[model samples]
Target: MKIVATPIQGVYLVETTPFQDERGSFYRAFCDRELDSLLQGETICQVNVSRTEAVGAIRGLHFQYPPHAEMKLIRCLKGRVWDVAVDLRQDSSTFLKCYQAELSADNAYMMVIPQGCAHGFQVLEAGSELLYLHTAYYEPKSEGGIRYSDPKLNISWPLKVTDVSTRDSSHPLLSEDFRGVVL
Candidate 1:
């Protein structure tokens, strides 16, 4: 796997080298040694999967607060999606900056989002499945998110959002009163 740093610190776009043959193809999606080198000593503690059924479906802009913050290695397992990460680390050079990439089974690529970033995705095709290896387990009380269409962030989603969870729709916009810092 080759890791390329994004505009945001600690976030990366990882491209995997796939070996293909007439039978099919295979690639190493994750390796302890490789990730260890990239993350120093950070340990991945949980793995999660999300499956979306329709195009234009959106989820997240989500993150966990300090003490429960998670670093995520995210990839699309089936179909496609426009994956995005927003820097929320206060004092970071790229605070509030966003990075986006097309992730699909065909590309065999993954994105690494550090603890101080919020992550989200828009389904580019029906039946999209996403897999995430996280450095921390879910902590409901620590959960927080910004609205997908927050004017301050001005995320330019590729598609018109057709569906979103009520929770996501009800998320507060990023503002001075918000406790979480936008990295």
Candidate 2:
């Protein structure tokens, strides 16, 4: 695993080298020692798998506040997506800035999103599946979100958004007084 830092503090892009042969290929998706430097004492407490059936589906720009904030390592298992992370750390230099990467089975890459960052993805192909390793468990009361089309974010999604849940669509746009999350 090759971990590269992103402009946003604590965020990383992980690349996995696959060993290929006639019988397909193999690669280590996660290695505790390899990521020890980044994870510190944090251990993955939850694993999530999501399969989106339609292209142009938008999932988030979501995070948990304070005590429930999570660190997520996301990888594409099938098809492709345009993954996005927005820095929401109030004290960080890159606060409100966004980073993007193309994640797909073919790329064998993952995006490591730290606590205080809002994460979301736009499906680039039909039937896209994603695997996620999260450092914190889900807490509905701590859930928070920003609208996918929030003017303050200025996210450049690659495709026309075709689907979004009512919950996501209902997330309020960032206001002028927004101060970001304190990690």
Candidate 3:
């Protein structure tokens, strides 16, 4: 696996090297030796998967607060998506900055989102699946989000959003007092 850095601190774009043969292809999706420098001492403790059924569906602009902050390594499993990450590290130079990458099964790419960032995705096909490796487990009390359409972030989604969950749509727009998370 080859790791590439993004404009935002601690975010990475990873390309997993795959070997193809007459039958199929084989690749190591994750390797501790190759990624240990980026991972620091964090270990994967949980894995999650999501399947979206509608093209243009939006999933989140979500993250957790400190005590429960998580580092996420996410990849597309079945289809394509416009995956996004927004940096919210309070003391960082790129606070509130957004970064995007196209992830699909064919691409074999993963996005590594650090603890103080919000993550979301827009489905580009009728059926899309994603796999997530998380450094921290879910904690409901630490859950937080910003509206996907928040004017402050102004995310230019690749497609016209066709569906969104009530919970996601209801996330408040970033307020003036918003100071970002301290990881």
By TM-score, the best candidate is 2
lDDT of 1 at 106: 93
What's model 2's lDDT at 31?
91
Clashing pairs in 1: 87-183, 88-182, 88-183, 89-183, 95-183, 96-183
How large is the C-alpha RMSD of every model relative to the true structure?
A: 1.6, 0.6, 0.8
For 20-120, candidate 2 gives per-residue lDDT tens digits of 99999899999989999989899999999999998999999899998999999999999999999999999899999999999999889999999999999
TM-score, predicted candidate 3 vs. hidden true structure: 0.98
Model 2 / residue 34 / CA error / Å: 0.2
Which portions of model 1 miss their true places by more than 4 Å?
177-183
> Which residue pairs in candidate 3 collide?
none
lDDT of prediction 3: 0.93
Indicate whether candidate 1 or candidate 3 has the larger TM-score.
3
lDDT tens digits by residue: candidate 3, 1-183: 888999999999999867998998877878877889888999999999999999999999999998999999999989999999999899899999999999999899999999999999999987899999999999999999989999988888999999999999999999999998987
TM-score of 2: 0.98
Instruction: Report, for every candidate in turn, its global Cα lDDT versus the true structure.
Output: 0.89, 0.95, 0.93
Cα lDDT tens digits for candidate 1, 1-183: 898888888889999978999999999989979877667788889998999998999999899987888889999999999999988887787888899999999999999999889999999999999999998889999897988888878888999999999999999888776544543
Error of 2 at 129 (Å): 0.4
Order of candidates by TM-score, top first? 2, 3, 1
Clashes of each: 6, 0, 0
